[model samples]
Target chain A: MRGGSWRQSSLTGIGVLFGVTLAGLLLLPFFALAISTPASDLLEGATHPLFASALLLSLRTTLTSLSITVVLGTPLAWWLASSSSKTARVIEVLVGLPIVIPPAVVGVALLQTFGREGLLGPALGSVGIALPFTEISVVLAQIVVSAPFFVKAGASAFREVRPDMLIVARTLGASPPVAFFRVALPIALPGLLVGASLAWARALGEFGATLLFAGNMPGRTQTMPLAIFYALESDVRLAIVFSLVLAAVGMLLLVALRFLPALRNFMRGGNA
Target chain B: MTSWQVIVRARRGELDLDVTFEGDEQPIALVGPNGSGKTSVLRAIAGVLDLRDARITVGDTVLEDTSAGVRVPIEERRIGYVPQGFGLFPHLTVLENVEFGLSTGKNPLQSEERSRRALQMLSELNCASLSERSVKHLSGGEKQRIALARSLVLEPAFLLLDEPLAALDATLRRTLRQFLAERLRLFQGPSITVTHDVRDVAALGAQIVALENGRIVQQGPLSLIQQSPATEFLAEFVGAD
Candidate 1:
């Protein structure tokens, strides 16, 4: 165990070399982006007429989806964490099923459910509310694909909270609702935030589902990822620039998660 | 009038705790080894966990009744609990923690009155200086005092303390025990304290209830139990110096 030949593991050395090489390979895309494109080119692409509209649409839909996710997912995650009923377990598994399934399959599933000839289509058509290819469909696709990220993360966060603490809060004259809002929510909020951020990022990057279910319509359903794809066919420079911007946004999400109180406490060790 | 009668028959496969007791104005000391169901009894009394067969009455109120389908919720039960090591709310300051009970009460006080009463309780506990300090920053002794102040501020029907001194070292435990004993004596209602230390019973002057293997092997005054042990386990447990 000391500084000796026996302590120097050949297996560990080989494992470390493989890990570094893989890590460097993963970083190659980012390196290529920096190597080929100047920063000013990304600015030029940002000024493109299609870029502004697509970015706007992406921001609007992602924001709406994130709001919807937090509102619905908070209670959903809480119920899942605390409830021991068989139905709750079933619902938890169903909600998590989306995360494991491919986004394109999710696209087809949504299409089969909401398309004009699909499951709820006749009823929805009778009401004259078409979902497919509409902006609302874009938001729906994001929600289907992204809300699970928040719910799963939030449920895990809620589980991390000590049941004893909640019981103690109740003994201190806090009603179940009051204790939930005051004690449990505050304690689990950081995890919830992380979950929300993950959902938002997922919603922003959503591609196959949006393309299949919502369709790429300029100034309506086209998000940043869609914009990048469209630009790739018409203009390669703008495509690369759009990609750089998307990568920056993803990095921004990571930085934002680090600043949250929950993650900060986690990084500093289990003092909380 | 605050006397309570508790009859619990709880069986979780192998773990069984069938206990029956009645007391008024006396601090009941729950004594046993690690797996003796002492914590379970406290949880049952606090109304957080209901036994399979239980009828617990405090004063005139029936907190739990298996046959009658009557079970008061934990908040409405009005029982105070100081958990093992006193898990104080790390988010709130001393005064805020004390005020939390009042803030969430059925009929909460005006903001000024809540703060006034919180500070008053802190003064009584000689911890007014810690009213602004966060619970996370306090030492073990300070946290214990603040926890007591938090529970007492609620004016609960009775206090259920789970190993209050178990987290402290010997010297600190000795000091805090004397403080707790004096404070409990001055309090108006009954209390229950779980402990493994025989000296704790001797110091607190509480009636002893010895539990082993999820059953009450002995229950009486410490002097009585010391003279006549109910079983071999109680003999060694209670009669020890």
Candidate 2:
């Protein structure tokens, strides 16, 4: 027993050592990014035209993609959460494919589907529509890659809502949609918000797909990550500043995710 | 008093349940071991579970009749169901949870009217103090009462309770069972209650319908079932020789 206790203590010690090492490795870059530059450099970067256009474009495209993801992914997530069928399982796998597929491959696939000589080429040409090297393509790429995160998280969130609650809601005279809006949605709100935040973060940092599908235009389709890439070729300091700004935004989202539960409780009349 | 009849022929996974029972005013206690499909029976009656073949009627109103091609949607069933552990809406306050039904359905009341009715129902269930409180902060017994109020406010033709006191501690279970008995009396509607404890059956003064392997093995007054229990589960339940 004494030897076992000593072994257990050593195991715990080793676990903590490895955990701290990994955390340090992950956090050191961010800490360096903050302390390496004076605040004035960050301010200068924020005021730059490249920073302004990239920030605005990133915000616009990511918001649009996130909205579309929520609108389309929610029902699909709910269906997946409630269903126990083979088809739902297959579709869930299909939805998850983009998350693991390389972003450049996704860009190529998008090009093939919506490009000038692609599958929908003639149909789109008839309507006088072209999608390559556009802001809309950037939004499309973000949606394809980021929506799966929301759907995966959203489905699990909706599943956490007990089926019995919906049944009771129905018995209480709430229609199917009413029950969904009143009970399921509110119960799953915090989780859905977390998922949306993750998807938005992914969309904000999207690079390879945006680079291929939406060319590196200065103000039109150039998002923040693309701007950072372009800036890095000639101006490393500017790239660092852009990285710092993106890191700050991402950190804000992370902090918001941490407080979502408290916010939900507050909105529900401070019940918690 | 509405006379309620339930005929459930449902197969879910391995459980092939076929049960038929009827009651009026008196609360029917469905005592069965775990995995006996008692809750499934209640769900079938409540129109939440689709049955292979079933007929549920309260008085002359047919809630479901598969052969007749008449199956009412869950919201239109008007069979108040308080599922096991009392499935309260966690996002709503007690009053809002109770007011949910009143805010919807074919005849939705005004907001003031909804609150009034919800408060009245809460008062009837002796839970008026908890109206503004969040359902998340409610104790088990309080949740049971609030759930009852939420369902009873609608005044459905029948009430189906699935182990209404199953989630409470033993000491609280006794008190809540007594409370539930009184509430059932006041309700005066044909109701079915699923339970595992014989004490719950006696406390509620409910007629017993003992189930085994998803089928009704024996059913009668508790006194009668005690005299001649069919299955070993029923024998153990009634403490029969």
Candidate 3:
């Protein structure tokens, strides 16, 4: 009994030690940054014109990319989740490629596809359009790198929906589109919201692709992350402050997400 | 009156079902052991399932004639389907769930009238008090009532209820079975209900069809089927042995 009890307690002790160690490891960098940078500096850097525009530009482009992804990804997600076809599986993988590929590879691919003398460049030129090194390119780059995450998460959300409910909706006189919008979309909103948040965060922090595809132009393509990179080269304190501000914004959004009652209920029910 | 006339030939997994029944506005009870394709029969009529050699007609209109390549889509087919799980919209209030059927683009009723009609249906079912409640907050019996109210508000040409009260507690099942029979009388169309209980047959059915091994073993009025069991399975099913 003594040996057994000692072994059991020792195993539990080891588990606790590992758990606390992992938690401390995860929080160490954040803790260090918080103590190193004063809150007053964070507030000041957040409001400065250069940092402020970058923050505004990041929010604008990410929100735009997220909106575009939601509008396009929802149907794609529903189809991927519901279909039993091999072709659907192939399409899902194609759509999901960005999540596995290096962001730099995606940037190079995007530039090749849309840059001057690239595949669609001649066609775009005929219509008097240039896409590279602009805010549009920034949004496009973010989308190319981040849409796969949204699609993957969105597909998972759609998978949780019961197909029978949609069938019942159809029998209640709702056509396929009507049933999808009025029934499926509402029930899957929480999952879709989670997906949107993930995609939004990913788009907000995108660096490698935007740097390659959308050259970091201040007041345009230069987002918060890009701003932090440039700030670090010239002034270490400025970079630290900007990084703290971005982390704070992200934390605030995550806190707000938990408080949304509908999502909370859906998530709770889902677990049950 | 809208009648459910379907000759369904289907193969689900290993179960090969070839069953035909044609009748008027009387609730038909499909009683059988599990895996007898009872639910498949109801699903076939609801157009939520694809069946080989199925000829489904509502009155004279051919809803699905697989031979002639005529299959009506689910929305166009006027079927009120209550799935096995009740399939209520969890995110919606009971009133909104009921209002959903009436607010369809194909529904002629305006938004105001649709709301009024949905409320009246809820009130009739004694579920008006629960109308503002989210469906996730509802008890099984309450959700069942709301589901029925939602289905009935459509004034559907036919009702397809898959083991309606199976999810409820025994006490609630008995109460809701009687409640369903009373409510179904107001519906002009016949309902095809799938059940494993003989009491469900007595409370909710005017006609009963016994299925075994994916085929109808016997069918008639509930009393007739119960009194004169056609096979050992029928006798066992109706508790006559």
Best by TM-score: 2
lDDT of 3 by residue, A131-248 (tens): 9899999999999878888888888888877988998888888888888888888777777887888788889889999999998888988998999988888866778887887888
Candidate 3 per-residue lDDT, tens place, B28-143, comes to 88888889888888888888777889999988788899989999998888888999989998877888899987777554578789889999999999989887777887889998
Docking class of predicted structure 3: medium
TM-score result, candidate 3: 0.87
Query: Pairs clashing in candidate 2?
Result: none
Deviating ranges (above 4 Å) for candidate 1: A1-20, A38-43, A84-94, A262-272, B9-17, B33-35, B51-53, B65-70, B212-214, B239-241
- Residue by residue across B37-127, what tens digits does model 2's lDDT show? 8888888888878799999999999989999999999999888899987999887889999999999888899999999999999998888
Across residues A1-272, which tens digit of lDDT does each residue of candidate 1 receive? 55566557876898899999999999998989867877677678778899889888999999999999999999999999988899999999999888899999999999999999999999999999899998999999999999999999999889866787788899988898899999889778888988999999999999999999999888989988998888899987788877887889998988888777766555634342
Supply candidate 2's per-residue lDDT for A232. Answer: 88
Q: If ranked by TM-score, best first, what sequence of candidates would result?
A: 2, 1, 3
Model 3 misplaced stretches (Cα beyond 4 Å): A2-11, A38-49, A111-132, A262-272, B1-4, B9-17, B50-54, B60-62, B66-72, B107-112, B186-188, B212-214, B222-232
Interface RMSD of each: 3.1, 1.1, 3.6
User: Chain B TM-score in candidate 2, rounded to 2 decimals?
Assistant: 0.96
Candidate 2: fraction of native contacts reproduced: 0.89
Clashes of each: 0, 0, 0
True contacts kept of 1: 0.57
